[model samples]
Target chain A: MPKKNLNKLREKIPLLEDIGKDGRVWSDLCKQYGVENPDPPWRITLESTCEVLNEGACALPVLERRDEEDKLSEEIYKDVPYPERQLLALAHSMIKKGFFREEELGVQMEKVYKRLSAGT
Target chain B: MSKSDKHDHNAAPMVDEISDFEVLEVAVRELCIEKGLFTQEDHNEWTEYMHTLGPLPAGRLVAKAWLDPEYKQLCIDDPVKASLEVGIDWINSMPSKFGTPSDYCNPRILVDTPTLKHVVVCTLCSCYPRPILGQSPEWYRTPNYRRRMVRWPRQVLSEFGLQLPEDVEIRVADSNQKTRYVVMPIRPDGTEGWTEDQLTEIVTRDCLIGVALPRADRKADDKRPIHKAVHPYGH
Candidate 1:
């Protein structure tokens, strides 16, 4: 993408700031994709964030993604698409802004992923 | 001594054995304390804080807005700041300065105009704005409610004894995301000269959730069937 176009797209998604920030990403997503929040916007955002990263790659920031072994999950990192990982990282940054606690993110993300997959 | 007395004594232990949740709750609390993750005082203080919360503060916020146009606009423009006027600091009031883990911080007040109405539902889970409005009702947390409210809002509202005109726009605010919501219903016709206290009394939890409208005479939520517990906690 052109630098200007990328900047414009970034500017449009103000929810990039935190989990609880304004729903700029939400309204923009709604307008661009006709995706109405069939549930609370945050739940959908959390679910989507997990979905986009599921068994693909760690999209979180370098420091944030560090495991006890100082290595990425070999199973998750296998064959992860570059663009997909980039998107996941972007979503992680947004969540880290306020919605996430460093210690609980893994557990919360797993629960959210399970709940979304359950389709309830 | 008697046959019936023997049966009653046997039933008591069965009821005592019913709580798997209590076992998990004890395990978590003990583990957290043992690990020094949080002190007993911290848990007790949060319990105290939970006791302090109810729908009153949120109701008062709506009442204050109804009585003042500028405050009402502030409510729409900056809900977190406006929440302070009603004595709720979303971030600071609780033990966590960052706000509740699940509820987050931002609150969206869906302003009801003459033609439009709003209702809330969490299709995934029972995600409510508990900071100001206290815990959600039992029915609000039901999977049945979560499934039906989004698809058939009018029917659900009707079940709650709230029927609107066909011309009225009923917007369902699905609380699937982080941003919590409360519906600021349009001020009713008869409450013109009522004091803030009176106005506050009428804005029950249901009204804020947009299942019911505020009225001059009504001061409490509609009673519903509450599933009784074997050993319910004493308040």
Candidate 2:
């Protein structure tokens, strides 16, 4: 697909927006994070392209956060390709565990970030 | 009578247009009865069950939820448990004590908040919540709908006349697994003091499917072209 249409397709799938551009971008990111290559990259391709057209409405901010916290999860995801279900399951679990208070997870994350930065 | 003008009084008109599907249906039904797989009474009872189903139960569920915050929370938290409030015992409602073999028991009610909207489509097949929402529409079962709705929900929803703001998070739930989903849209503004029954009237099938929004004035889905069947199931 053309770059413009590919971007359009990417908008629909929020999960893939953090992985940079194209399949090669993902492979390159994996290498940077010392992660194994996801052969075929079907999960990223299918989930990113086959999602509803949410554009960058929900993705842009989340991708920025992912980039900021890249080191935190580098070891966990170093050996496997990113799957959409895992993300969804994690979010649902977090919600259930009170990791998110109402709509603003920012408040909870801020407290964690402060505690971590203070080395306590 | 003259050779050209003579009518054949003893001859009968012959036109056989039965499709392969119809022929197979008859054969399989007769074979089942003969083999005692299920009696004719079972088939008739199932058909009767189908007749009793429609979108009313689902609509009532939504309506009841709108009226009561606790009930609404139950709908969002545990949809299967909430289903019982609306008279749908997924386990014992049908002949199978364990629930309908195909639809299963779990129901996921997608609650649309101010900033989020939800729609559902079975990417692999038409796996609908039949016990609550009744039969899946012909359009929902079409391969065209299944393929496009997941990819181009905005465009398809526009065809259905639902255009949401860009800020709204449009979540498309792909019902590929055992869980089935229904969209419980936030109660519209016009129904300020509406009763549950009145509110239920506006929660049409399309609204439940996330294709259309509920309005006090609108009680039915938009009209579409429907091809007549050779032998229609219901009048």
DockQ of each: 0.02, 0.01
Query: What class would a CAPRI assessor give candidate 2's docking?
Result: incorrect
In candidate 2, which residue ranges exceed 4 Å CA deviation?
Answer: A1-120, B1-28, B35-37, B225-235
Q: Which candidate has the highest TM-score of all?
A: 1
Alpha carbon lDDT at B19, candidate 2: 20
Residue-wise C-alpha lDDT for candidate 1, range A45-102, written one tens digit per residue: 2222322222123333222332200111112221222222223333334333433333
Q: How well does each candidate superpose onto the true structure, as a TM-score? A: 0.57, 0.56
What lDDT score goes with residue A106 in model 1?
Answer: 38
TM-score of chain B of each: 0.82, 0.82
Q: TM-score of the candidate numbered 2?
A: 0.56
Give the CAPRI class of candidate 1: incorrect
Which residue pairs in candidate 2 have backbone atoms (N, alpha carbon, C) closer than 3 angstroms, thus clashing? none
Instruction: Tell me the lDDT of model 2 at B86.
Output: 91
Residue-level lDDT tens digits of model 2 in B55-164: 99899999999999999999989887899989887777765456532467888899999999999888665678888998677567544567688888998788788999
Instruction: Go through the candidates in order and give each one's C-alpha lDDT.
Output: 0.60, 0.58
Cα error, residue A62 of model 1, in Å, equals 25
